[model samples]
Target: MHPFKMLSEYGPLLLEGAWLTIQLSGLALLIGALLAMPMSVARCSPRAWLSVPVRIYISFFRGTPMLAQLFLVYFGAGQFRHELQAVDLWWLFRDPFYCALLTFVLNTTAYQAELLRGGILGVPRGEVEAARAYGMSAWLRYRLIVMPHAYRIAFPALGNEVILLLKGSAIASVVTLFDLMGQTRAIFAKSFDFSIYLWAALLYLLITMVIVRIWRYLEKRINPHLQRRVIQAPKAVKTAVTATE
Candidate 1:
């Protein structure tokens, strides 16, 4: 079948899948970001007690594949079914959708927290010292100065992470969750049409383009001072004429 006709027939199914992909990615990013903030702080703390556990958490998640994490949550949890049921938590771990969501959120948080930690460490010591000289409290310094600067430095990296998360959401299909990739696979399996996969790839590309554009727009908004100035001829010409006059 022609690509357009195939799309016309299966467009709604594809759209539904895309919507699920968006929801999964968006929720994971939001919740992951929230969790990562404190994790980043802990990871950067001076005390070993505070930072060591965070280091381990980040290392394990970052070191392992996301698919493994999803599998552990979705399938491996079955081994603990009795324990989970006793705690009234079986409902969360039993559902593929919830398991996928949990895995993605946890996985993203590990990566994001490290990015944020890098951002935090990148803050200039001199600026921090200046804040200290101004008699700012530690909390005030973090809230007013440190975090803002950290986020500014980390924005591009965080945006990249979000894009990666969006792509990674395709793994949801592996856990029996019908995301865009899953739906595409189903269509291909049924129709035996190669064009459907092409359509899915194009849709993924479109989504990526949209994400990149939004990130660029936000970069401009976040750090407008970094934008290049259109250097025109210096007013030196007008100044020379006025002086001659």
Candidate 2:
């Protein structure tokens, strides 16, 4: 079959796979971010008990390869099938999609928590002191001041994390999840067409470009102060230039 004809025939399948990829990555990033909030705070705690466990978790996830983590959840769950079945929770682990999702959430949560911890620490002490001076409760301060500023500081890194997670989601194909890469591989097996891989690459690049644009827009919206302000020439100078022209 002609390459374009092959693409035309399988384009919808590729799109469906791309959509699945987006869903997987988007959910992981959302859940990871939510879980990261408390973990980040715990990571910042002065108490050893509070910080140590979070430190260990972050270290383990960050230190390990994501593929290993995915395998542990997807394949390792079988090792405890009887125990899981006894607990009536085997259904969740038995599905490859859920196993992949669980692994992604765990991995992204660790990285996001560390990023947020850095952001929280970067919050200016004087700003925090001023909030304290205003008689704000700890929770209130976190809600009103600290978290917002921290998110602003960490927004770029968080965007990078999401992009990384999106790319990493391709590994889900290893577990039999029909993500974009999985579909590409399937099509390649039948068609023996190398161009299918190129199409997959283009789709990945297009998705990434969309994500980058959206992230940049959100970053600007959230941190308007960081955007450079446009300055206009003085009215007199403009008039003089206009007259000269």
Best by lDDT: 2
Predicted candidate 2 versus true structure: per-residue lDDT over 100-209, tens digit per residue? 99999999999999999989999999999999999999999998999999999999999999899999999999999889999999998988889899999999999999
Residue by residue across 1-245, what tens digits does model 1's lDDT show? 97678889998999899999999999999999999988998899999999999999999999999999999889999999999999999999989889999999999999999999999999999999999999999889988998889999999999999889999999999988779999999998899998888888999999999999999999999989988987665698878877999
Relative to the true structure, candidate 1 reaches a TM of: 0.93
Pairs of residues clashing in candidate 1: none
Global lDDT of model 2 = 0.95
Query: For every candidate structure, what is the RMSD over all alpha carbons to the true structure, in angstroms?
Result: 3.7, 3.1
Q: Give the TM-score of candidate 2.
A: 0.94
Pairs clashing in candidate 2? none
Error of 2 at 189 (Å): 0.7
